[model samples]
Target chain A: MKTSNKSVNQEAKNSFSIKGYFLRHIQVCLASLGRICRSPVSSLMTIAVIAISLALPAGMHVLIKNIEYVTSGWDGAAQISLFIKKGTTEEKVVNLKNQIELMGQIDKTEYISPTSALEEFKRLSGFGQALDALDKNPLPAVIVISPGIEASSPQQLNQLVESLQDNPIVDHAQLDMQWVKRLYSIMDIINRGVMIVGALLALAVILITGNTIRLDIQNRHDEILITKLIGATNSFIRRPFLYTGILYGLLGGIIASVLIGLSIGLLSDSVSKLSSLYSSGFELKGLGVDGTFTLIAGSTALGFAGSWVAVGKHLGKIEPS
Target chain B: MIRFDNTTKRYSEGHEALSSISFDLNEGEMSFLTGHSGAGKSTLLKLIACIERPTRGQVVVNGVNISKLRKSKIPYLRRNIGIIFQNHQLLFDRTVFDNIALPLVIQGLPHREIGRRVRAALDKVNLLGKEKLYPVTLSGGEQQRVGIARAVVHKPPIILADEPTGNLDPELSAEIMHLFEQFNQVGVCILIASHDIDLLNKMNKRIITLQQGKIIYDGHEMAPKSYHNHENIQ
Candidate 1:
């Protein structure tokens, strides 16, 4: 019984010690934040620099995402026009349409008989008198096919066209490759450009944070020395500075998120007007909860890394002697 | 408790700070280290705190031979020893309460316990009512008392001071010495480095006098009261 009681008391001490450890960390972080708050001008300056650097990449990423969304809608508008042989029966054209619709890459197909094609072309082509002069109908039966949304890339659509042309009834399958190729290349270039810019801007954030933390260390040289003399461990001496760096990161991240959101909101009005003009149902999306979390997490990580580098280099040079 | 075995410290600039100095301080003993300026007094105290290692010999503090101790363990070792500086070294940015709470905070004591101990230490230094005032607002003696309060707040077994009362008046310095005596009465080993010879003789404790980086004297009764006890005359 005595031994059990002693063991339980030791266990209680261990738990309380762990609790105390975490509680101290919380206190230090709050104290560091309070310290930053006391110096509003410099802290605001650092936070602003960090926010701008982070916002650049984050804004670019969101812009690229919006572009992808708009372009994907354009992809849905792309179509393959299948022209049938001049004498192909309406029954055979409809059969081909049914077969094309069954293809995994094809979304749906529309069959237009020769008479209907002639009527539509004559009515819209401003050549009704010329078309009436012909004794026989010359327009070919056609099938219009839209590729599945998932397989609507230029390569996939071209492959589907090639396969359709092999059908006995299909005389030729045609789509505008020039614009599709241009659109895809543009998207590729923009994606790569955004990636490069994002990476460079992220590097800028780290350097900014690192320089800020370095200055903070210099400012607190006396306090650090005194703390060290009082037997504060290196980590204890390091805690507040690290918290300062993290605060810079966290605040920067939050501001960047807000900047992105505001830019999206500001641009959304113009975008809605333009999309309405083109009768597109597309809407712009800002960085959602996930992106906000990722931004904050990523910048916080960068802040931690930057401070670690600065403190590891500078803290060793300070001695109580 | 401290022991220095043939310790010699030489700076990289070729100045020898201490030369083969040997001494042992027992647990609960209170002593004074005295010399002129640049007598290696601060250097000696620094060695005991493991702030500077000897160029040659071993230093043992509280049964730990810190000469072989790793750098990572230095803070843990320092927790067993408290040091007071001549300049008081109180952070002017924080209140006296926060300054005194530093060591306890470093030790990660619970908030309630830290408050209790910091108040107790303040009471000991007779500065309990001035806890919230910044060090810059306090007088020189008050600042030194805040330093002393911080040093003893953690309740380490050993305390070291380097001219702790160097900037204070005679009355305040005597009061500080009396506070040291009270702590010594409770078995806190204290080693103080001071240049005040009159005060040292009045205390009647063991005195280790250094001259030119060497221990010239290490006897208990070398003060004027025992000048006749030494028969050897040059």
Candidate 2:
């Protein structure tokens, strides 16, 4: 009997010390979730505000990513144009093209003879009759060298152009990098703007969650007092509120993901049409798995932080007086 | 199990709620604190529960000098104490069982254990079948009995009640006092604050009467029950 009693005591102690902690947390977590569900209208209103706040920034980020994707295909336009010297032999032009192609920075080199260059220019410039007036072609044989994607930055392109200009057979080498630089600068500005807006919206989410929790604490004033009187620790009283905040954050993140998906679906057709008109195959991209996960995790953390602040500020003010 | 040594509690408003009050109630002892309204009965009980700190001297419970206890340690101290209020502060939103199980839940007891103990406490208070009912639906006396069940559910060593029978009729008040007596029989020290002279006379327990923040009487020996009744009438 003594041995059995001792074992029973040990079992009780172990259960209370280890499993009891997790049990209490799980109970509170579910209880807070149930409380939110009991008041669906109010809970949804809070969640909707949080979702819109999260969706605005998340949508802008996805838009920026898609814009970057579309612009990446235009990188080939920043090619370097090398004008061969007049009276250069065809064999020498061919040799120059072979040498430029062998260089790692040059992706491909196209050799345009003077005859084809003049013909293309006449066709594009609408000066065929005038060009026919001249006996010899005045256009130089040109070699358009497209740089490798890795070497397409403005500085890399400038360096490649300068080195080609040093060639004795090249008259002038030009790179149309102005537009590329302008596009990158615009993207940078927009990215910075998105960051600022995201930060402001995140703060809004925190404030909204905090205010909701504060009202909840007020509504449960007597409950808190009675709980405190019965010997509840500050952490014990704060657990349910913290769980409530986290639930709000989690639901908000899920709704934001859905909203982003809906908006993407709505705009995808228009985006594809516009791209097809531009003769490009760009498609709108939605928030992928990683993005959704990050959004939910981030919003949950924000919720925890918001409730931490509110609980810290309010729970202490309530005593058993 | 509880002691007070020249304890004084002065509010910030310059009113002394308890002054130089001293008493000792041993383990398994049951006592009554009686006086007119605002005569320091509630304040004395609050000091024992550490809800209000004594402005001077020591207030001790279970051998701990609660006057010097840390804020974080107060909860642990209170876990060994059960307090019932005059208003029977029950959460109307929860069922009677949930209300009674609160202290055990705070202590992180197992679910099955909490249910067993809550029912046992309810049985003790004769409120066993009303576990699922909300407090608002219960009568005033029944509600106070639920409060009593909640206080003793955790089986704390000390039980302090401040006018727990204030709203109950004479019969219901006797039933509540009988529950306190039953708890005292099991080695729980009890201190009930009230001004019910007739009830106190019938209990014949130690009665500590306070007048204007000072103890005027502190024993069961009475100078003629009629004289005490006359004093109350005056």
Candidate 3:
């Protein structure tokens, strides 16, 4: 009975110690955060540095996502009209339109009469007198064909053009796609550039946090010596510093998030106006929940890791002597 | 309990602070360690505390060869011994209550237990009412008392006080010595090192005096006796 009671008491003590360890960590975290709070100016300045660091990547991320959203439904290549000879009549063009529409892969077919073709040329090319001076209207009755959406890929459209070129009645096949492909490649390069910048900035953030924690450990040398002398475990002594790092990172993440949001807000009007010049009302995007969470989590993790590394190195140098 | 066998601590540039010396301090007994400034009194305390290991010797504390102990076990050993510094290294940033409660908090006592024990320790040191005051607000002697209160707050088995009253007047010094006596009466083994012969004569405890890295005397306190070529020790 006595042995059983002793073992039971031992179990209780073990459980108590476990609880004590966890609660002690909470107290340390609180104390660290409290110290930051007490020094408001320095804390804000530190947080602002973090925020700026996080903002660079976060802002780029928003811009990329917005660009993706804007260009999501755009087609790289668009079909054009193939003008027939002037001698061709409405019957000739209608015959060609009907023939093209009957094809399995053709999306749309339009037949323009000689008179309508002449009016379109005058309006589009601004050559009304030349369009009207001709005795019998020198323009051709044209047949325009747009490929099926499913068959709109570059290879498929090329095959369709080849088939069109083989037609005896058509004069030419055309496409308006030169500038679109260039724009796409430009966007791709920019997206990759943004990712590289983000990675480099993340490294800078870690270095900032590590150096800050190093200074903090130096400042608290006396406290650390006292703590070690009193039998405080290394983990116990390190907890508050780690928490301080985490706080700095989290606050910085928040600041960065806000900065990104405000930047997006400020840019939204200008971007929309610019998009309108392109006849598109594309709006700039703000950071969503995942973005906010990533900023916070990434910054916090960096803070924790930086402090851990700095504190571990510096803590070893402190001799209870 | 502590034992140092053939302990030789040599610093850089060929300075052997403590020569090949040996001694044993049994458990549950009060003793004093005294020497000149460089005679290694503090070094001996530091070695027992495991703050610094002997350069070439074995240190056994509480039946365990602590000198051979791993780095991980150092904290456990320290939790069992309380140390008071000559400068009374109290944190100026913390209140006297929080300062006294440091060791207990480090041990992770419950909040109420921390409050009760810190108050009790402060009461013992006669600094009860100044618990809320910061260390900077306290006098030199009061700060030292706060340090003493913090050292005893966790109720360690052994207490090492290095010149606990070196900076105090004789009246406060005796009062501090009486406090140590009260603690000794409660079965806490204490080792104090000091330079005040007047206080040492009045202490009336077992005294161990050191001179030039050697134990010149170890005996019950009676009266000052002239010794050949030894520094005045208290």
Using TM-score as the measure, which candidate wins?
A: 2
Residue A14 error, candidate 2, Å: 9.2
Encode model 2's per-residue lDDT on B1-234: one tens digit a residue.
899999999999999998899999999999999887888888888888788999998888876787777787677778779999899999999999999999999888888999999999999988889999999999999899889899999998999999989988999999899999999999999999987778888998998888789888889864245436646687
| C-alpha DockQ of every model | 0.40, 0.40, 0.33
**Model-by-model lDDT, in order?**
0.85, 0.88, 0.81
Q: Give, for candidate 2 chain B, the lowest lDDT window spanning 10 residues.
A: B221-230
TM-score of each candidate? 0.87, 0.89, 0.82
Q: Candidate 2 on A1-321: residue-level lDDT in tens?
A: 234334333433443566678878899999999999999999999999999999999999999999988787677678788888888999999999999988887678898999999889999999899999999889889998888877877777888888889999999998978899999899999999999999999999999999999999999989998988898878899999999999999999999999999999999999999989999888899999999999999999888888888999998999876
Tens digit of lDDT per residue, candidate 3, span B110-205? 899999999999899999899999999889899999999999999887999999998899888988988888888888989998877667877787
Clashing pairs in 1: none
Tens-place lDDT per residue, model 1, B1-234, is: 799899999998999999999999998999999877787998999898888989999888887776776686677778778889999988988899999998888878888998999999999999988998989998999899999999999999999999998998899999999999999999999999997777888899999988789887887865433322321231
What DockQ does model 3 achieve?
0.33
* Candidate closest to the true structure, highest lDDT: 2
Alpha-carbon lDDT of model 1: 0.85
Q: Give the Å error, residue A230, model 3.
A: 0.7
Q: For each candidate, how many residue pairs have backbone atoms clashing (under 3 Å)?
A: 0, 0, 0
Candidate 3 chain B has its poorest 10 consecutive residues by lDDT at B223-232
Please estimate how well model 2 matches the true structure, expressed as its whole-model Cα lDDT.
0.88
> Residue by residue across A1-321, what tens digits does model 1's lDDT show?
234334333433443477788898899899989988999999888888888888888888888888888887668667889999887777788888887787776777788888898999999999999999999998888888877788778778878878888988789899856776788898889889888988888788788888988998998999998888777778889988888888888998888888888999999999999999999988889889999999999888888888888888898899987
Between prediction 1 and prediction 2, which has the larger TM-score? 2
